[model samples]
Target: MKITVDLDPKLVWQIQSEAARRDLTPGAVLRERLVSSRNTLELENRIRSRVMSGMCDADIAADLRLVVGTIAAVRRRLGLRPNRRKPGWAA
Candidate 1:
C-alpha cells in the first residue's frame, strides 16, 4: 500500500534524520512512532485498571515493568488517594 500527503519540509527532514540515526527507513520510523504511541495508551489503560483494583503503585509498576514514580503520577492524576503502606513494610 502507498499513500502520499504533504508534510512540512522541516518535519520531513527531521524524520529522515531520525531514520538515518536509527538505520531504518523513513516509513519504518513513522511506524515505530505510531506503535510506540499506541503502546503508551495501552500502558496507561492498564495502569488505570490496576489502580482501580486497589493495587499499590509499587505493585502495579512491578507488574507492568514501569517505574513506580510513573505509576504514582498516573494514580495522582486520576484523583486517587495514595495507597497505604502495608503493615511492617519498609522502603
Candidate 2:
C-alpha cells in the first residue's frame, strides 16, 4: 500500500542521509524510522503519564507490559523519582 505524506525539507534530507548510510531506499528508511519513532513515543508517553500520576514502578511495569527496569529507565530519562506511594489506580 502506498500512502502520500508531506514531509518537510529537513525530514526529507534526514531520510536521504539515512538511506545512503544504510544502503536502503528512502522509503524503506523512512518507514523503519517512523515505525520505531512512533512506537517509542507511544511507549514513553504511557510511562510518563503513569509516572507523573504517581504510579509505582512495579505497577507501571505491569501496566506497560514491560519489565520493571524498563519503567525505571523511562523514569530516569524523564528525571522522575519513584513514586513510593501506593498504586494510584486499582490493579
Candidate 3:
C-alpha cells in the first residue's frame, strides 16, 4: 500500500541508519516495525485481559518481567497498583 505521513526528523534519520545497517530499504524496515508492533499490541492486550480477570499476580509479574524487565519500575512511576498482591503482603 502506498501511503505518506509526516514523521519526526530524528526518527526518520534513525530509521534510515538502521535500514542501511541491515541492508533493507526504509519501507521494508517500517513494515517490519509495524508488524512487530502489531504482534506486541495483541500480546499485551491478551495479557492485560488475563490480569484484569484475576489471574495470579506472580504469573503476571513473571510474564511482564520476561517481556519488559522495567515494567515494575514503570508501573511504580505511574502510580499504578497491581491487580493482585503477593502472598504474605495482604492487608
Candidate 4:
C-alpha cells in the first residue's frame, strides 16, 4: 500500500527521528502510529457512545477517574511513575 501524503515538516522530522531510533523506516513508523491512533479513536468512540446512551455524567466521570487513578497507581507500583502533576491542577 503506497500512498502520498502532505505532512508537516516538524512532524516529518519527528517521525524520521523516531524511525531511526527504532531501526525502522518512516513508513513503518507511520503505519504503527496510524494503527495505534485508529484503535484509540475506536475505543474513545465506543466509550462516548456508551456515555451518550442514558449514562449519568457524574457516574461516567467517576468511573473514568477511578480507572485512570488505578492505572497511575499500578504504574507507580511497577516503578513507571509519570512526570505529570496531580490530577486536579488549574489548567
Cα-based lDDT at residue 41, candidate 1: 81
Candidate 1 C-alpha lDDT tens digits along 33-65: 889989978877898887776677887887888
Q: Judged by lDDT against the true structure, how good is candidate 2?
A: 0.87
lDDT tens digits, residue span 1-91, model 3? 6999899999899899999999999999988999998986675665566456654445555655553334444344444456665565422
Provide backbone clash counts, one per model: 0, 0, 0, 0
What TM-score, over all chains together, does every model reach?
Answer: 0.63, 0.67, 0.66, 0.62
lDDT of 2 by residue, 1-91 (tens): 9999998999999899989998999999988988999998898899889988889888888877889998899889988889875734654
**Could you tell which candidate, 1 or 4, scores higher by lDDT?**
1
True-vs-predicted CA distance for residue 56, candidate 4, Å: 4.8
lDDT of 3 at 67: 34
Off by over 4 Å in 2: 1-23, 85-91
Q: So what's the TM-score on candidate 4?
A: 0.62
RMSD of 4: 11.1
**Candidate number achieving the greatest lDDT relative to the actual structure:** 2
Q: How many backbone clashes does candidate 1 have?
A: 0
User: Which of the predicted structures, 1 or 3, would earn the higher TM-score when compared with the native?
Assistant: 3
The CA lDDT at 11 in model 2 is 90
